[model samples]
Target: MNVSFLRRNRLLAGLFTAVLATGIVAGTAAPASAGNSHHKKIDYVALGDSYAAGQGGGRYLDECLHTKAAYPRAVDKLPGVKLIADATCSGATSLDVLKHQIPRVKHKLQKAELVTLTVGANDIASQEIRETCGAPGAAAPATFDEQRCTTLVLKAIANVKERVLKALVKIDDIRDRVKILVTGYPRLFAAPADAFQARANAAVDGLNAALHQAVKKANMWGVRAYFVDVTRAFHGRLIGDRFPWLHAEGNDTWHPNKWGHLAYSVVVIWHVKRIF
Candidate 1:
């Protein structure tokens, strides 16, 4: 062999050997990738009723029982998500979630890393209240019998409170490794400037107050459960702002519109990011 050609061939072999040795050393000394080894895989599950299901958000996934607009889908976008089940149905109350959703999980809850629940709206007939309050001539009642409305709302609140507590207990049993999130209701009515509107607003405030109290009692597990307050975020805008995620008045009034879903996603993401 020509001496110069022989030297060049040896140099090429040396470079190849060095490359193979570097890879072997790396494989033995360190992990395959910093992301692969240290990254924690999370199983995220969403529960509760319509708000969590994204009833009118205009897009949905058939298999997971989810709407694309709901916060779970948004959360799945985060890194290291291994599984997500957005099985919350449109009319589910707190009990429905605890009894129905928990049994349907094919994936084990033992590995759950996060959970988000938006419930209690369906514990009573909120739509009926609105219809009665806004009846053609119900406004300015001669006697102002708030009892009829208050009783209906209170009953609903009480039922939801009990169910929520029960659900939280089940959650604790399945996976204390999970971070639980409980969200308050979004403003369903426009803030009012008069007596009738004020009464309606007070009713809504009462419902949210009940939700807060329920979460407080149930979140004592040290699982980092927290409530997201979205009531004030849409205080004045819910009525006519063409909210992206709020359904139009006649279109399933209680369900969220696309924009409303986006807003929900933002609030959840804001809090969820903190834990990581």
Candidate 2:
């Protein structure tokens, strides 16, 4: 609650920063419990958008931009955690996960003990950010069209119920034993230097809010699903900062850089340890 106290604890400081920036979490901070609680290896299957695909980390293995530096790969490095499959791809939507990525896993999904999904922002929010702000090109946008951005963001939030939540239900419909850890996107900017940064950050907050609620709704349906909030993982090290973990240019623009993926991996592993 106090600066000196937070300064003494980096973890507390990080959560404090997340609260101020990302606003109220839709559910409890403790992720839903599932999986074998005993420390065990996971037969993991990674699915969803570019963030899940490791898009910005580095050289890609395919058109999907599935880089070796992806957070899932980092997690796979842990002892006994074998990567069953990573069907993540850039620009994938919730439906894309159900239609394409899921099928790629085949019977593996039933065998997999842990599945991680990061979707929905690409469904509508990011496009609105690009519209209200500016297309991510050489650098982060300096200006923002607040009125239009806000309008589009509102629609995107509403769309989340139908598009994002439904996808969760479908995934939940699959074998219930498989634990689904649905991760939320992080704020792309640190201090939010201008309208573009501020509004873009807000847009992600809206997306995450809807997503958090969606996961809660899934849990109420008796599904083994949980929300992994990584909103403050890049708290003070976001875009507009000297050492941003997100890409400022190239095809990976706005996607997490290698260091960013590492941070994501840490948040995920921490959550996994806390839950399991």
Candidate 3:
């Protein structure tokens, strides 16, 4: 069996089991009051980590790095849309969102028509992985040890799925009628510039795949969850690209820049129309 393929199957199976354990099933169409109607002002609450907080976009609103140029703010500008709260923070994990961010937005979410979540990257420690695996002159065994990397990536993906499910359950408890868009992270490089870059990009692919599966399971469990793929929106604009929308190499490397945030907003706005 292909090792990568097997890992993906395992990750998806874990997500299915997590959702099944919650005892929720994809049901009939949402109620008319599901908040997609145009007559009502949509209460939007943004949740999750740095990407959702708009860390790299600058113009910080607070320590959380919530920016006026962020996708949520762009979405907020839409007709009949009102941003009730932005509980996103730069270093938030899924557990952090569940513990700290959720409480802050629970009241607002109770009446929210739309909620956008961009999490799970921090849970899997993408930044840390890049730092370790892509560091200059890092030593590796003479013989490739694919199993070691596979094991670590699989475990990380599973943890992300578990935490994401838990967070989704909490959101469901608070607001069952809202449309939840769970966005995935984009590949940092359009093409691997080196061996370490290859490994790092592979890890990102695994993370995105896990997030996609989690969102799918959430929808299966009648949670009204949707995965928004920003990969295509980020095409040809990776870290090494000539006109990169993401930070190249620094403390902020891989985070989307202002143009990237605008692209994210476009993808989100397209999905928002479908939901509302």
Using TM-score as the measure, the top candidate is 3
What TM-score against the true fold does each predicted structure earn?
A: 0.73, 0.77, 0.79
Clash count list over all predictions: 8, 0, 0
lDDT of each: 0.64, 0.71, 0.74
Q: Kindly report which residue pairs in candidate 3 clash with one another.
A: none
Task: Give the per-residue lDDT digits (tens) of candidate 2, residues 1-276.
Answer: 657434534664364345323211213322323222233356778888889888888888999888887878765654445678888888887778767877777577777777888987786646545655564442344565567767776876777655666666665566566778889988887787776678778878888888888888888888678899987767766788766778877666788887777678777766655444
lDDT score, candidate 1, position 270: 59
Regions of candidate 2 where Cα sits further than 4 Å from its true position = 1-41, 125-129, 132-148
Query: Which prediction has more favorable TM-score, 1 or 3?
Result: 3
Give one digit per residue, the lDDT tens place, for model 1 in 1-276.
558544643553454344323421243332334124236366688887778777677755663345777767766665444445766787777777878887676365666877888887766555665454453233444454567767776777787777777777677678865677888876655644565556655665776787777778876655456777887545444654433235545645656666566667666765665554
* lDDT tens digits by residue: candidate 3, 1-276: 658545644553454344323211123222344333354367889998989888888777898878876888777766556788988889998778878898887999999878898887776565544344434433544555566556666777788887787777678879886788889888888778787678667777888888788888877788888888888878877887767779986556778887787778777876776665
lDDT value for candidate 1?
0.64
Better of 1 and 3 by lDDT: 3
Q: Which stretches in model 3 have alpha-carbon errors above 4 Å?
A: 1-40, 126-147
**Ranking of all candidate structures by their TM-score, best first:** 3, 2, 1
Best model per lDDT: 3
